[model samples]
Target: MKNDFTLEVYSENAFSVLNRMINIFNRRRIRIRSLLATELEADYKHGMASFKLHTTAEQLERAMHQLEKLIEVERVVRIN
Candidate 1:
């Protein structure tokens, strides 16, 4: 069975940050259903990225783990 997952990532607004996130999904051949990115605060350089993806629970967990390991990533949460 497949599960729908929403990942919220907080990180610096750097190209590398977005690249790393996309790479994680690409490496696993997972397609993102939707992606939204916005700046966290006007005074800060941090941003938030939200991604909706459909995949197995195991793959979701693995992706979450990899996201947390990135230096640019401050936090990661699964909305559903």
Candidate 2:
């Protein structure tokens, strides 16, 4: 049921945003298979966090929705 998601965080405070996202997963008890953050090569000023979690589809959707509401987050989308 779990899926991969690519999150592009646009704020200057990218580290803070990543921390908050980790907290979100922790609080929800979602076990993450892989969580990686990398600076976007095209947009040198921005960063992207890629997450692969072990969770249900509904739970993933809810988490993505919540992520989109964060101030430091730019966009949340499930990757194919």
Candidate 3:
């Protein structure tokens, strides 16, 4: 069975932050189906990034854990 997972990451608006997030997927050899980034707050430029990937439950959990560990990531949420 395949599961589609969405990772919502809140972090600073910077290219390094985005690059780090993409590296997580690359290192896992997971292909991201979609990636969206937007500013959450205008003043601070807090960014929200959503990544969609289809994979097994175990891999999804691992990916979430890795993403949460990033210093720039303020929060991580898993979406069905």
Candidate 4:
């Protein structure tokens, strides 16, 4: 079953990494409901990208795993 999710992805150069992460969802045919990307701190060395997605739990787990595999992605958190 599909459900709504709030996901936060922390990474380096969050803006740049957005494309790659979006591509993962695109390939899966999952639509992104909303997105917010910004540097986590003033240093710009780290960033956080938040997204609202509608998808099955299985797909969510797979996507999170793939996101973690990314070189720039520091971690992924499911807020809800």
> How well does each candidate superpose onto the true structure, as a TM-score?
0.94, 0.77, 0.89, 0.93
Arrange candidates by lDDT, highest first: which order?
A: 1, 4, 3, 2
Which portions of model 4 miss their true places by more than 4 Å? none
* Runs in model 3 lying further than 4 Å from the true structure: none
Task: Summarize candidate 3's per-residue lDDT along 1-67 as a digit string, tens digits.
Answer: 5677888999877768989999998898887999998888868568999999877888878988998
lDDT of each: 0.92, 0.72, 0.86, 0.91
Candidate 2 deviation (Cα RMSD): 2.9
- lDDT tens digits, residue span 1-80, model 2: 66544444344345577888888778888887787787776656677787777777787778777788888788776774
lDDT of each residue in 1-80, candidate 4, tens digit only:
99999899999984558899999999998779999988878788898889999999999999999999999998899999
Best by lDDT: 1
RMSD of each: 1.0, 2.9, 1.3, 1.2
lDDT of 2 at 4: 48
The ten-residue window of minimal lDDT in model 1 covers 12-21
Candidate closer to the true structure by lDDT (higher is better), 1 or 2: 1
Better of 1 and 3 by lDDT: 1
Query: Which clashing pairs does model 3 show?
Result: none
lDDT score for candidate 4 against the true structure: 0.91
Worst 10 residues of 3 by lDDT: 37-46
